[model samples]
Target: MALSTAPGPPPPGLSAAKIVAYLHGPEPYLLIPDPTPGTHQALVRWLQGRQAVAGPVVARTDAGASLRWARTLLALTPQWPGTAGELLFVEDHLAKVVLFQDPLLAGHLSAKWLGRLSDMTPRQRERMEQTLLAWLEGGGAAEAAQLLRIHPQTVRYRLRKLERIFGGSLRTPQARFEILLALKIHGMAAECARLRHRAEELPARAASEPRRDARSIGR
Candidate 1:
């Protein structure tokens, strides 16, 4: 069953079975059986209201693993570097979760596919990566142009450049899949860097803010 760990009384249409008492604290979990679309939406809304996140459905015996998955999802939230949300669902990001389970492997895969692009300027690299990923996802310049909101000719130009860099690698199915996964990992890494920068700035930002004196509160 899926689990939500928002601290509060359970919502309507939920039963006693939905509530799981935690061994350590006042916080409780809601167990969702058979997460239909309606139920998913309901859980999403409930969690959103509480600014919480939920883990994927697993057998009751796998509750510990489910909580581990939830913590992983949490680590990717807000300042955690990847997706930020009031209520993130594991089902929506299963592929990413699976892909990131081994970050060292993911890093190596990204380096294998994207290492050459590092020589280019950031702007040049961004454009090429976006165009290439879109092309890979859409299977053609026209479809990729639509996805990127660029002209087909522009996509064609980028693809030609990419062809020179990637050569016959893009023509094979396995290589294409690997390149696509690598590009996604690269993007996630970029997001992580940005989030880390922002997080580092937080302490300095807080220290710079003026503190109010306790005696001034009643003024």
Candidate 2:
């Protein structure tokens, strides 16, 4: 796979038959031999048709590395701002990918920054954590309020509470960085947990659903 900046259909000279496309499990993959800008254009069109989101197309020199890179991008999809079906590229989120590449490291950081806050009730902790992240990312109470869809006064209230819990550490650059990263990691972790629960229920869901015969469906 090769990365191309162009977006649209394949050039007239590029034959669709040359691109080998197939579905592996729930993902659709394409193998374009001697992939060029035109090939990538075609791929963009194909993905758009299916309303799919994908990772950056990596070099084929190491198939294993390519697969791993793709999986990493997919795992971090929850952190991205795009809605379902938008074509998002890994290039846009390289920093986050590196920051969260190691779950053990991310978990450690999350614990370090959030351990005290976790002692609070689940709902309160959630609100505080979200407020902290919004404040850090937005840089002010008004901006944070817009992000959280809450009143500016409410944001100030949470910030005051967070300041008491976190103390002057929130004033420091390094602590703020760690807190932001930890909060983001926590969000992604929650998404992963939900996906796991859904996967575990997949078999039961399939069994519970009625199946139709191929012939009967066509009749």
Candidate 3:
């Protein structure tokens, strides 16, 4: 008996179980009956030969397997920094099968960077957030100082304090680039939650409104 193997989703007449069995079988054997002699038999032999070659080739090239290995390494060591959820998400996204296999990039973010920002006092975080927004809005140190109602030197000092807490050389363009992205993502998430809450409030507000039109008609 000759075997048939098709790539991707199973053929119309085949079930998933049969397809899996064919792919995972120890030897390169097709479930299909042997084709006729001459041209058909030659084609079947060529296809079987290709299938034998393809199985090992796919296993060698599997990106998911490589990602699993990288995840295992991360699990074994706590050297990589950041929130566990953040690290896992970043690792999974960057380790997608389509992306060429490479070492996990999440390790580049230091542990200090991933530590709890909540450790900073709420006032400190609020001040830092204001300074960041001002800076992002193209405010110079003087403008930021005016916005915060602080001296220019105080603005500079607070920025330095923020840099220390964040654990990155924000002075460099490259470092600033990464930090800005992280900050923007965090801000957007907060904004989205706020907007969703406001949207939920709107329905209740509309329901509570007095029936002005009906009252006027009755009057």
Candidate 4:
């Protein structure tokens, strides 16, 4: 089937019509096109090989299917220095899949969620962060209240505020799972940054140390 190279809508053609119809369906179907002669074919073969090992087999076709497949893949993958929409799309998708594949990956996804939470008011963010830390360190409401130096009822109030901020639906098991995941991610990133700063200071610290052994050797 002939493909359209037009900037606007796809030209009236069987391939374009078929693709439009396929996209409207629920079951995921990737439309990959045959590679052009020479360089393109080699690249296509390489991509095909890579995809073979990643997960499920995506189908190939000649009607702009490969472009759609690539767009979808890129959309699902993380992007830096780009639109928030792209980042959010990738974060959401990764949260769904990465948790199943790698525990560490879940932490990274959670960090992205925390990044979103950072946009909230400072008071709200502080309350939630304190609550989360207390919950993690202490486990139960009583312990959390002790850590925060607040009464149990006050702790409950703060938690309820957090629940409202996070939304009532998120108070459930699955939602809490995501919230915990995000908190871990944020904590890991903070720890990593702290470690990195300490490492950077080491060289300066080493340089500033007195050369006692050198002076003794010279004498």
> Which has the greatest TM-score?
1
User: CA lDDT of each candidate?
Assistant: 0.73, 0.69, 0.45, 0.49
Q: Highest lDDT, which number?
A: 1
Better of 1 and 4 by lDDT: 1
Answer with 2 or 4, whichever has the higher lDDT. 2
Candidate 1 lDDT, 1-219, residue by residue in tens: 222233445466444336453423433455556566766666565555343546777788986777666655555554422223366677787776677767899999999999979889999999999999999999899999999999999999989999999999989999999999999988887787787688677777778999999988989
TM of each candidate vs. truth: 0.68, 0.63, 0.40, 0.42
In candidate 2, what residue range of length 10 has the lowest lDDT sum? 1-10
Candidate 4, 75-110: lDDT as tens digits:
233322211221112223343344334446665666
Off by over 4 Å in 1: 1-52, 79-87, 210-219
Q: How large an RMSD does model 4 have? A: 15.0
Clashes in model 1: which pairs? Answer: none
Quote the positional error of residue 199 for candidate 4 in Å.
1.4
Question: Positional deviation of 141 in candidate 4, in angstroms?
Answer: 2.7
List the candidate numbers ranked by lDDT, top first.
1, 2, 4, 3
lDDT against true structure, model 1: 0.73
3 or 4, greater by TM-score: 4
Backbone clash pairs in model 4 (N, Cα, C under 3 Å; residues 3+ apart or in different chains), count: 7
lDDT of 3 by residue, 28-131 (tens): 23332222344333433344323211111124346345434434333322221221211122234332212212224322232224233567777777677667
